[model samples]
Structure formats: structure tokens, C-alpha cells
Target: MESDKIETESLLENLCVGLPTIALKADIPTPKWNTLNPYFGAEDITEIVDWPEFNYNTIIHRYGGILNSKKIDCVDFSAPWMHTEVWHKSQLDTRLDELVRPHIIRTLRAAFEELEPQTQQLNLNPVTFGHGTTAITIGLFWPDTSFTTVAEGYAQGKNRAPGVLGISPKWSSEWRHSKFSNDQHHFQYNQTLAELNFYMDGHGARCGYVLTDAELVVVKRLDTNGRLAVSAPIPWKTGGNGQLSVRLGLWYLGMLAAEEENWAL
Candidate 1:
């Protein structure tokens, strides 16, 4: 037991050192569709003329209209369009597709690469979440074999089921019941850490922890609607102080893992 505790503490210290500090900036600009001359007809332009600036949600919504609306004819559209039996499909302008999507993807890829050690060190694949102009989603990766261990560690931390580690299990349950009970796919990944932060923020408490073989996973919930989030693993080290502090979620998971060896004993 003594050796196990020492090992856990040392691991915690390593994680504290591994966690990278990120500089948050609002840089990605929303896509502006109205600027396209022939793609948007005069009437379509008039509808969005009052919009002060481009927004991802707005652009996506309008783009969906172009794809789904029977009223929109490809004659006036500049981009290449294909006529499907159900709807008109067109490739987005290179300015919108390449400039906007690739930029966000690259930015996120770079940030994650910087924060997470190469998979050779941890044997995990990074998975991203969230949607919008900003890279506002947490990325998590773990080896398949370690899932139960991590889940159990999280359960031990709270002396309860692992469900509580979720952003808002109750709210998620309610939402599932009200809207997604019949749709299994809908319930899969709809909940975001940002939503959890919104509901729990004012209570002076938040849950931010998940067990990892590497000792810790640092996650940040940046927005209420789950538009922005970040996460990365903190690898373990030996003979180091475990006096490091972390956000609520990661702290809880770390506490659980600190007692992990005891679970086997």
C-alpha cells in the first residue's frame, strides 16, 4: 500500500508537469455567404443583408437551405451543382470550404499535437468533439483495454457510478427521455462539458476528472453551449511532488486514480 501511494503521488506530479497551458484567442472568422455574387440570389442576399457579420451557425443554416430548398435553382449559383432526385447539391466555394474548415481543423490539430504526447508514448488516438467557428470541443483518447479501469477509477472517486462524471447526467437523461429515447444514435454524444459547466458554474463546484493510464487528463469547458472545449493527457513521472492543482473534472479523476492500486488489493 505504501509503495502504491508513492507511485500514485509520483504519477500525479508528472501529470502536473505534462499538462500544457494554452493561450485562448478569438481568431476564427465566421463564414460570410452573402459576399458571393452569383451563388446567392438577390432575394437571398436581401434576407441576410442586415446581418452585421458572418456566423458559422448562420452560414451552415443557409447552406443547408441551398442544399434542401427546391426554390433555389442552380442557374444563378456559381459553384458546381448536381441535381439529385430529392434536392440540389453543390460544392461550397473554395473560399468557404478550404479557408474556413481547414483552418479550424489545422488549428485544432496543432493545439492537440502540442498538448498530447505522441501516441507511441501513450498508445491512444485523439478524438475531437464540438461544432462551430471556434475549436470549442474537448478531445479525448484512450486505449480500448483501459476503459473499464478508468471508468472504475472514476466510480471509486465519488463512491458511486461513473455516470456523475458526465456533464449533466440528469439533464442528459431528461433530454434523452423527452427527445431521444426512441433514437439511440441521438443519445450517443449530444451532451457536452460546456453544458455541464453552464448548469454547475454558479454553484462554486464543477466535476472535471477522468482516469488515464498516464495519470491525468486536463479538460477545459470554455462555453455554455459546448461551442468551445479542450482536453489532453498528462503523463506520469516518478519521485515528484503531487501537490499540483487542476480543474474540477481532472481533480476528481486524479483522486480516483490515486487510489487505483487499492482497488486491486
Candidate 2:
């Protein structure tokens, strides 16, 4: 059974390596239309897509518009999910209040407090005010200083489960205090990292950090039609640097949240 799992993983690894080019080639449209005949010869390639008729621009507008609508934009900015430090909390405070009312905040907080007692009340710190597209270290727990090479530690670290990004988890021995030895050379911890900064301009977007926490464990599960879902894992690390890192761009964290909700339903 274990060997079969290894063989299956090896096949998937190879497939993943080739998927980018395959997807690029497959997405190109051709003018080939099928007929009732079992076989047919080549014909002049016609216009593949009627841009005016279908109007993909309108489609983008439709999708983006719906996502942009005030009705759908009913996310509570003050919610614990948006929890940043007190200083940084201001960036979201005034703007989020524009969308959500005090009553909503109270309701959400009440619910969260019941589910997780560790949730701290809003302190509205000012330290979290900043903006940019760069890497932010969410949190770091078990620091391993044993591995000789970062590549080795990275490979072992990635063996845990579903990886973040396509990089397949590389080690950062350069960040280590010393050489790595045991698998401890590869620490196991949780982080609430973000690569997206703000939504749009100042009107739609605000200058603030998305409130988050330390030691957020994310677990991936398979769904229908090759989709995936991620769920929160139980925090394992004890004391360490709990931070929130965000970059400016499209993010997959939203997808993880959606999957978690879908799985819950």
C-alpha cells in the first residue's frame, strides 16, 4: 500500500511538472467544428471566436461587477477574521464601519467568543498601518538548527501534506541559527500569511492590514471535480513569533476560506 502511494505520488509529480505547458496549449481555440461524419479532412480555419457576439469583456464585467456589488460586499471589516494588532486596526476600523454596523459587530463577536474563548477583544492598535506588496512572516514556532542543507530540510518539511504555492516548500537554512540535523531541522508550525494588499483604490480599498492571528493551521482536503478544500487545524506550536504577512496581488487564501465554508455546508 505504501509503495503504491509512492508510485502514485511520483506520477502526480511528473504530471504537475508538465501541466503548465499542457494547459497553455489546450486553452488555444481552434476553428474545427464537428460533423455527423465519422471522419473528415481539414478545412480553412474560420474565426475561432466572435468577440462581439460573446463579448468576454462583458463577462469579466459581469463577474467582477457581481464581486464588486455592495450587496455581495457585505463582509464585516471589524470581524475577528480581520483581526490585526491595535495600531493596524485603525486602517480597517473607519472604512469597515462604512459597510457594517455596530450591531453586526456585536453579533459576530458574540458568536466567535462562544466558539473560541482565546479570541481577544478588539484593542484597535495603531501599529498595523502600512501598505505594500511584499512578504510578511505570519508566525514562526519550532526553529530547527540541525539540517546541513536547506534543500534537505525543505524536502522533509514539504513531506507533511498539501503545499502552499507551486514551489513545493524549499528550506531556508540561511535563516537558520545553525546547521540542521534531525527532521527538527524542519520545524512544524502555523502561520496566517497573506499575499494580497487592499482590494482596489481608496474608495473600495482601505489603507490597513487584514486582521489575522498567529498559528493558523490550514489542512487541505479533496473535493469534487479535482477541486480542493482547506480547513483550520489545531495549533501545535507553543511560543514563538506570531505575525501576519501580506503581499499585494490575487490570493488563494480566499479560495481556502470558500472551500472551508462549502465543506461545512
Candidate 3:
């Protein structure tokens, strides 16, 4: 475990070199959406597309440099929302895919090509909901499995095998009524939730990234209303007890992996 600290610290330092420093600003007001204009207007598209840092070359260059030549594929687990049944049955005929698919695709491609030039494919799983809990569960509970296996399993809606860490909002609710609700496992569950809350609150609605040999899956957080939460790239702590530092997107995945090991044995 001590070696893990040394290695992650070295990795964090290397990744942070020459990277832009951005801190999450606290108590910033979330932007209000105009329901009268149900669709994103020109200004909305311009704001995202014209953002230079999120452009193709810059994102690819940054993550590629961090991985140091590791071949990578990029996956988006949020694609399911594109074909959501409610949107298909809506009176306005509004399609969520029409709103942001282009921008999302562009960013995903930039990350894919930059991370793994040899693999030119971007995998899209249209079945997985990919909320924060699902993403963290995959990373923490199944660290040894390849990314492809996990992605495909989620896409097919397979239950995780036994003796693995599995907790969802519903599971949390059920546990609250069970006898073991006040026990040690419950304490760990609360700890995990606290950490997630810290990530979201402290980082101000940023996305999560799980980097693996086979793929890098980006997990975007949505507000209670199912709208995309505004996010910025901020530096955040990766290890519990505030030990290692990394960019916010990478930090959640690293934290899950670290804690999984920390709690083992």
C-alpha cells in the first residue's frame, strides 16, 4: 500500500506537469435553462463548440501525454439517453440526441484518437444508464476485469457476480429497512456516499473518467431533473484522506480503485 502511494504520487505529478490549473469555484449559481426555447439555440452550441480546450487536438494531446503512449479506446455510457422512450413519445418531438450529439462525439473522438491511435473506434453502449453509482461500482468492484467486459456486461444488463461491491440508490433504500442497515457494511456504504457527495459538491458538477487498458469511459453527472450539470476541469484529490491529487475526471476512478484496495483485508 505504501508503494501504491509513491506510484500514484509520481503519476499525479507527471500528469499535472504543464497542465492548466483550474480550481472549482464554490457556491457558483447553476445556469437557468429557458424552457420557452426548448431546444438549444445557436448561443448554446457556440459556447460548447468554440471552447478551445475541449477541442480535438488539446484533449487528445493532454490525455495521451498522461498515459504515455498507452493504446486507448474511448466509450460514452450516456448514449442511452439519446434513445430514451420519453423523448420518443414526447409531444414536442424533441430528441436529446439532436441537442448535443455532435459536440459529445467530437470530444469523445479527440480523446480516443489521442489515447489510442491504433484503435480508431469509439464504442457506444446504448443500454447502460451510467449514473455515478454505476460507474464507481464497475471501477471499484471489478478492478481486474478489462473495460470491454464491463461495458458489454452493463450494455446487456447483466447482474454483477456475487461477493463484489454493488450498491445503488435502490439498494441503499432497501438496506435502510434491513437489519444490517446499522452495521459495519452500512458504515462503509455511508462512507462511499460521503466521498461521492464530496466529489460532486467540492468539484462543482464535473464528469468522471475511468481509464483502463481497453477503454476510457467518461461519466457525466446529471441533475435531479435529468439535465446536464455544468462542469469545469478542476484539480481534485484522488486518494482517501486527501493523499494524492489529479484532475477531477480522473480522480473519481483513482479514488475508487484506491479505496477498494484500502478496504480489502
Candidate 4:
């Protein structure tokens, strides 16, 4: 259990590394949040928090003075990150959690702290399920619940990352079908076939993203061949859509990852 506890200093260190300017600020008063993190951040699946931000709004911004006292560019979310708003609002509703929760569990189970592009989603499976005459594709669906805000998604498990992944319906179906078949060989024996869905819960991770100073990458979880498909890094700070600040994108991602439990199913 001690090993399972993410060291606060290290977790803070990881978060601070390449961290966007404002991922930690939210409604909570900074002093109050800093006090609670080391405890709640340790909770596992047993705690079963229905909402993820309850912990993070209280945790993420405690990285000390630089993020605390300093003001970076006087960031504005509604203006620049307005693109961070959820798209395709109808897809993965509350109805699919049972089907999707497994994906989130897999991510938690397979979680490690690596921030490089792991692989690519060449298979692009699309999952189409029917509810009345309306049909939704898993990869194309939206996370109406997972991430209401980006800050919540970024604080997701502090595993650190780079890239956005959009899983196709076929890939989604494949992930559902594979469902851990021969999964043991993946982690223990270095034979990975799972696409590593990170913090997937409600929005099915459709719009999930990862970023750093140089690049903005959309990360998709692919199940067809156990490889990750990372979108080409779109420069974040000084390229087209430069207004898409790393802070806002991360905040958007924080919400996606926050919907961790609120996500998959």
C-alpha cells in the first residue's frame, strides 16, 4: 500500500514538470487545497468517488509559489479555450458506464508515469450501438460527463502525458471484444495489445488531449492492436490557434480525466 501511495513531493514534481501555467487554480482557496492533497490523492478504486474534481480542485494547484503567487499571461478560459467545450454532446450518456467502466479500470490498472508518445491508432475501430433510431459511434462520441472542465481532467492521476487520442468505433468495439483476452502477457511479459485508455470514464475520452510547451497532441485509446495513436503535435504556444494555451487545454483534459469514473460506462 505504501508503494501505491503517490508521493506528494514526486506527484507535485511530476505535475510541475512541463505543467501548463494555470491547471491548478479553481474555486478552492489555494491554502485550503494544499492541506488535503497528500491524503485524498492516495485513495484508490475502493473509495469510488463519483466525482473526480472534488479531490483535484482541492489538490492540483498546490505546487507552491511559481503557480501560486505568480500571474502567467492573465489567462482567460472562455476566450482562448472556448474550443475546450464538449463536442457531440449526445453520445456516451449515463447509460453506457457498465460497458465503459472496464476501459477506465484498465487504464488505472495499467497506469504508469510516462509522458512520451507510446504508439499510434492504425486500426481505428468504430463502435455503433443503437438506442431508439439514434446511433452513436464510440470514438466519435462525447464525454458529456467526464470533463466539465479541463483542470479536472489534467489532474487525472498525475501520470503526466503528451498527445490526444480519439478512438474510432471499430477500435472501440475491438477494445470491448478484446476485454483483457491474453492481457496477462501484455504487462508482465512485455507483450502489450491494449491501447492504454487513460482516465476513461464518461465522455469515453473522445476529446481527450495532452500538451506541453512545444506541442499539442490529441491522444486516442486504441484497442485493435494494443497500440496508442498519438495525433501529430500541433504547436501550442506559438502556432496556429496559439490562443489554445497549454493551461486551458490541460484544464479541458483535467475534466476528461476527472470524469474517470463518470466516464467509460
Best by TM-score: 4
Off by over 4 Å in 3: 1-109, 118-129, 132-154, 157-247, 251-265
Quote the lDDT for 68 in model 3: 41
List candidate 2 stretches off by more than 4 Å: 1-181, 187-250, 259-265
Q: Kindly list the per-residue Cα lDDT of model 2 for residues 142-203, writing each as its tens digit.
A: 11111011122322321111112111022121212234422332221111111111011111
- Using all chains and alpha carbons, the TM-scores for the candidates as numbered come to 0.20, 0.16, 0.21, 0.24
Tell me which of candidates 2 and 3 scores higher on lDDT: 3
Error (Å) of candidate 3 at residue 28 is 18
Each prediction's Cα lDDT score?
Answer: 0.25, 0.20, 0.27, 0.28
TM-score, cand. 2: 0.16
Residues 72-172, model 4: lDDT tens digits: 22111223542232212122222122222233222222221121132122211112111211212234332222323222233232222222222121112
Clashes of 2: 19
lDDT of 3 by residue, 118-237 (tens): 332322222212223332342222221111113345333222211111112211322222356446434433333233323432223333332211112233334422222222222222
Whole-model lDDT, model 2? 0.20
Lowest lDDT block of 10, candidate 1: 84-93
lDDT assessment of candidate 4 = 0.28
Q: Which has the higher lDDT value, candidate number 2 or candidate number 4?
A: 4
